[model samples]
Target: MDKFEQRLDQAARAAWLSYVGGRTQDEIASQLGVSRPGVQRLLALARQEGLVKVRIDHPIATCMMLSQQIGERFGLDFCDVVPVDTGTADSSYQYLAVAGAERLERYIERSAPLTLSLGSGRTVRAMVEALSRLDRPQHRFVSLVGNVARDGSSNRYDGIMVLADKTGGERFLLPAPVVAGSVEEKEAMLGQRLFHAVTDVALKAEAAFIGVGRIDRQAPLFQDHFINEGELDELLAMQAVGELLGWPMTQDGDVIDCSITRRVTSLPLELLRDQQLVALAGGREKAPAILAALRGGWLKGLVTDETAARFILDAES
Candidate 1:
């Protein structure tokens, strides 16, 4: 377009023709009516200015390492690694979220009836925000967990709506709480036709996305006081380190079965065997939960920052 850039681009093309196209430098010089040395100088300039930028691409070794480690550890399908940006936790998470969203888009394009289960966490929230930027025409989004919080601050329905609207598909909102007060209450809710239909939609999902929650914080397992204190206490006593799709998972990524979790109608981890289960997370604070989730086999695919990746590897090793 401009003089220097135009000349530089021309020089790059000429050089590539000479070196890569198997044309001798003398032949190229004769064709262009320039001296062989002149052609060499042009090639050098192209390299210096990065006009002839050469890309050597292979699967990222680090990603493969982690993916293979996780897959073998948990028996998963695949894993993707996003490079860690050396910066604040928020920015690192932002990079992970964007990459995770891109990966999700690719997966949706390849898979069908995506059984998406979103978790309520800052990391997951960021991932959903990133996904909102992508344009996809078809894909079903399901809320793997209940939306209402005990205090009513946030819910899964909001997240499910964001995902469904972005992907241009209907969202199935789980009306029941993620954790229920009683097995009977959970059973009764399932008995209702509306909730049963929603649960059916969730169970048939082909892919799911989730986030891990810490044990210290009172996670919004159910939107509004649906899961009782006794159940939460029991989960803690089971040494539960985190949760995925409303299931309490231990430090080793094993799901803890309190009577309440068993009664909940959410899809079980074992059911996710052939499905694409992706977990997006970041921060050193979440290393235990993330590693546990990986070790426990929560994710067949993972998107995370470098800091968290290192932490997961270190903790696992």
Candidate 2:
């Protein structure tokens, strides 16, 4: 390898030792036969290169209280509140991804077979990347939403295949677009035998991890070109605050019954109401949408950052 490659390799090794192996800088220096200062620099290089992702395993008192309060208020079976990374301007998604990955790993580490459903989003994609590879062929990963766009291109954020690859498990993808040309087209796609088979697997999922999306011009649905500007304007006019599995919902968490929703191909929120639905979302921009989902009682669990958690609690108060 080139000298630069060697330096990168050393940096990665130093990072693994410090973060995953929990080695001190001095210990790393001894192991690598480098000076203590050299070890420190290598660790810094790792962080600079985005090779190290740090998450606090121990729960702080305030975060614990926030988690408890949110859970009790929302009737949630699970809630994890992570401290905001004050160093970074916006570390909401980063922290949420780490926490979500930890929770996903717990489910994948089980010995028995499991059916886990997932939704597509930037945060969920980051969670998949943060997840550690494990051998769990007995498990199955299924998509909770359609895996393609209106133009028939694959959704970049779909992580079912990646999860299956990581766990050596089976994967089932929904064979449709995020939204169809019309309500008839959506009904036809849902009526297909293959679509039914895949959704049947998703319906049996023991747990589902999804992302909450705000309803606005900057929304993922709009930004990703899944929905046109007119559709977004319609949602905005209807007092839509957020979306779950591509279904737009009002501030009260009621899924809006509109033209766009009629053409969405995602699994119905009603069918998932009683399932173990956990939303992995955060950031100040998504606070309102997250609150809407909680108010609707649609989520069984939530993984969020301190900022959004505070916003939700304050709004409810």
Candidate 3:
């Protein structure tokens, strides 16, 4: 475009012919009818003039292929696979969360009366952090599951509040526990005006992002005392592999409903039917839980690592 740029391009071509083409500078100079010193000067000009630009092309094909496979397997709207260059799961999860947050910001633009049902998990924590940096107009943010537990270790309230504040959205906090003590307590809490309002928000949510919780001894929700031992045993007995919106689901993603010691969930399976429920998770250990969430039909979108994506596609096959 400019004289300097044109000179740089010429120099770059000369450099390519001399170096990359395996020709010595003297040979290139002879072929191009230029002196050996002149060829060296051209190579120097190529670098000094900045004729090269470097960029990393993300493996979008891998993401799209995985997304299509998972979408077809679970009948979801779409799946987003984030490339994990690092071997660590934390970095991989962060990349996926950031991608999901960006995707959500765009989705919010196209969709109106957007009610967002947020979750609390490692992946969600990262998503909230990433989502906070994005600029967006005011909308409604709903807490799909209770943010606190009896022991009060993990606080998802801060994460949700951060996202809502950053997006200029209204926060609808769920007042009840994630898992109630008894059926009467569950009904009583759900009957309250405050809890009812949150449920209403969940029912009206245009898009919901939930995290799959594993049914294991090291489960975060369980370790945090969000659910009692009895409920955990019940879920394990029912062969539940994962949780969605605080509800137990089998490995195949079927909702496991029966007598349980505690139940405190905002949106039921039927209510989540038509809404966009995106499930974010990673790791081979979470595969069963992720699969369960898919089978339950609670996922409209999914963001995960390549390892999990391959496993999911292979599992279906």
Please report the candidate that would top TM-score against the real structure.
2
Clashing pairs in 3: 253-292, 253-296
- Show where candidate 3 strays beyond 4 Å: 1-57, 110-113, 132-137, 151-156
- Tens digits of per-residue lDDT for model 1 on 148-246? 554434553376777776667777887765665567877787788978787677777767777766664455553235555666777778898777767
lDDT tens string, model 3, 1-317? 59967667669888788656878888878877778998888988765443332223565887778877887877777787776555566566767677777666676564355667787677886676665234455678878877756654546555568777767778887776677767887888877888887788778887777788888877766887766687677778888777776777777777777665246555676777888778888777787788777766678888887777877778877
Candidate 1 vs 3: which has more TM-score: 3
Compared with the true structure, the alpha-carbon lDDT of candidate 2 equals 0.90
Can you write out model 2's per-residue Cα lDDT over 1-317, one digit (the tens) per residue? 59978998999999988988999999999999999999999988877655666666788999999999999999999899988876764555877888999998888999999999999888898898788778999999999988887778876547998788888999999999877888899889988999999999999999999999998878999998888899889899999999999999998999999999889998999998778999999878899999999999999989998889999999999
**Which regions of candidate 1 are displaced past 4 Å?**
1-75, 83-87, 110-117, 132-137, 151-157, 218-233, 259-265
Off by over 4 Å in 2: 1-54, 86-89
Give the least accurate 10-residue stretch of model 1, judged by summed lDDT.
Answer: 48-57
Q: How many Å off is the CA of 201 in candidate 2?
A: 0.5
C-alpha positional error of residue 30 in candidate 1 after TM-score superposition, expressed in Å: 48
